[model samples]
Target: MILAVLLIAVQVAAQDPRLDRLDPDTRAQVTAVVDSARLAGLPAEPLIQRALEGATKGAPGPRIVTAVRRLSVDLGTARAALGDGASVPELEAGVAALRAGATPQVLANLHSVRRPPLTMALSVLADLVASGVPADSAAVAVLALAPKARDADLVEFRRAVERDIALGAPPAAATSIRVNAGADVLNAAGPPPPGPALPRRP
Candidate 1:
């Protein structure tokens, strides 16, 4: 009876199609994470579940591997906090929320805030940084004011760009300001100087 049960368990494990779906690199990373978790006296099953949940939720496979790697570093802490009963989807949700700026205290409150489209938010934030706003400042400003921003709020954000430029802030700083504001605001504020025009050929 014991031999038959062991054979069935092995067959079930081998039949999981998702294990075969992972690319070679991702499989290696996942295996490494699972091994580390086992060594840490944590069950490997939860980590595997988290990876599968992330995959089902449309997170890239590389990101799933990265998340598991991070989890492996503190497997004991994770297990203590999350409990052995936590499902893979719950772990993925918690990690994603944390990365999105939810603190441990505020993490439970996340259900109240309507999440903005991540792609658009990232694009806008990146543009702000590229425009000359300091990355730290730009990130803060956008997060604080994004919900309240009107067309005119964008105008004010632009004014900050002009102020930064006039103050002789570096090009990178200026880019950050533009990111917090908007490109149209910068255009209206007037363009920054052109790089030295082609030297006249005598």
Candidate 2:
């Protein structure tokens, strides 16, 4: 019976070759979490990776299992907010946003208001919160731009807000101004033009 149990555990956790590095005991526990995630249709790779990361850091087996379980729960929460059709990247971004203090309702709201492939927008929202902007204000800025802004536009807007914050503007104030002014941080001449046009070639 014990041999049968060990074989099943190995089979369940063997999805990733790298997981072979974990001790047998840790592998079995982490495998349970990864299995539950896969059964729920959630991406299992991230959970596996998290366990491997903890192992790499030389954490105890219990610690590694706890971390993997927490990530699995987070993944489930993210999927609930992003909906069934959300891609793996979107759910991953939602997890990051949640960890950064953005609420699940904020994610659900973004899902309703924004279009598909929310990976970049969620990333930006999480980055903004990490940069000290209040989560609600950051959500407002992202929601304001989500209707029409492209992914590249969101990146530029984030940079501009960070710049303003670095220059002493309050985080929320900078976010509001950027959203109202639009995400064209590289406006006028666009990214290609440095200052004036300079003379073009010889």
Candidate with best lDDT? 2
TM-score of each: 0.32, 0.82
Instruction: Report the C-alpha lDDT of model 1 over 94-119, residue by residue, as the tens digit.
Output: 44434443343332222222132222
What is the lDDT, from 0 to 100, of the residue 150 in candidate 2? 75
Over 86-106, each residue of candidate 2 has an lDDT whose tens digit, in order, gives: 888998999999998888988
Off by over 4 Å in 2: 1-15, 183-202
Whole-model lDDT, model 2: 0.84
lDDT value, residue 166 of candidate 2? 100
Q: RMSD, each candidate, Å?
A: 16.6, 9.8
Cα lDDT of candidate 1 equals: 0.52
lDDT of 1 at 109: 25
What local lDDT does model 2 show for residue 97?
94
Clash tally for model 1 = 12
Off by over 4 Å in 1: 1-17, 78-202
